[model samples]
Target chain A: EPEVTQTPSHQVTQMGQEVILRCVPISNHLYFYWYRQILGQKVEFLVSFYNNEISEKSEIFDDQFSVERPDGSNFTLKIRSTKLEDSAMYFCASSRVQSENEKLFFGSGTQLSVL
Target chain B: LAKTTQPISMDSYEGQEVNITCSHNNIATNDYITWYQQFPSQGPRFIIQGYKTKVTNEVASLFIPADRKSSTLSLPRVSLSDTAVYYCLVGDPMNTGFQKLVFGTGTRLLVSP
Candidate 1:
């Protein structure tokens, strides 16, 4: 089965540095999303994207964060300045259609570690 | 999004059937109850989804009550490989053209031989 693939499975960066996480969602999927989970915590939604624009975002997605679909296949999340609290497993997901019944395919996840 | 509550952990032996129940008293009319499973260091994987009554796929079965306040995930003949964390989520899935899945602390199932 096709899957969402994320690059740099592990990322380590300085606290004040910028970081960009990349994802290649399923080729035919139209809706994309970003979620994060702190160690031993519940997974939290960050942002959702569709039609080349952000559909919704959580409070955690503040001024330091942004998402871009630079091309047909790549979805990227950028943090202008990283913080210790930003460290977590970031997941990328996609669905063919955004519906109550649609199933989402998730990437293994990018483990972001801030020093 | 409706908040869900489930047991923190469960233990079962191999070949036994396992049932994990989740409570969501605030489920909305458009919300669908879905379950996902996760192994250590991996993203959540879809298990089953249902709006009402029962829905079964090859991997698991989902049973939703008429009130839509609670749902159960049933795994038949579970094995050691079935040990993982299972999450129950309730949401419109497409409330604003995208599905924002909110995962609560999931139920951890440990299958022993």
Candidate 2:
């Protein structure tokens, strides 16, 4: 089964530094998304990308965050200035279709540790 | 997006059947109910989904009652390895352009010997 793949399984960064997490969605997937799960918290939506543009974003996706489909296969999330609260598990997901019952393929996730 | 409510945790013995129910009282007609299971340090995996009635798969079964206000995930003859967090999400499929899946604090299932 094809899957979404994320890089840098774990990352450690100091506060105020920029960090980027990368993902390679399934080759045939048309919609991509980024979500974060804070330790002991629920997974929250960050942003959704389609057609090389941001289709939607959550309030948690503020000025500090941005997403890009740098290439046909690579999607990235960049945080300009990280804070201690930014520590969490960032997940990348993709869905082949936009159907109500469609299931998302998720990566193992990139654990971002902002110190 | 509809809000979902589930129990914080559940405990079951090995070899027993377990049922976890999620309530989405304000579900829309176009919304579908889907469940995902997550182990520690990993991403959520699709378990089962149902629009209405009962849908069964190899891993689990999804039961959506009439009214569409709630759904149940049934795990039969579970084992210790089946311990994980289960999340229920409700969203419309037509809004595919930016369909965001909002996850609530999932129900943590602890299966022990």
Interface RMSDs of the predictions, in order, are 1.4, 1.4
Query: Alpha carbon lDDT of residue A56, candidate 1?
Result: 91
Off by over 4 Å in 1: none
Cα lDDT of model 1 by residue, B5-54, tens digit: 99999999999999999999999898888999999889999999999999
For model 2, what is the error of residue A8's alpha carbon versus the real structure, in angstroms, after optimal superposition?
A: 0.5
Relative to the unseen true structure, what is the C-alpha lDDT of residue A52 in candidate 2, on a scale of 0 to 100?
A: 87
* Model 2, residue pairs in steric clash: none
Q: What is each predicted model's overall lDDT from 0 to 1? A: 0.93, 0.92
Highest lDDT scorer: 1
Predicted structure with the largest TM-score when compared to the true one: 1
> Which runs in model 2 stand beyond 4 Å of their true positions?
none
| Per-prediction TM-score to the true structure, in the order listed | 0.96, 0.95
Question: Worst 10-residue stretch by lDDT in candidate 2 chain A?
Answer: A95-104
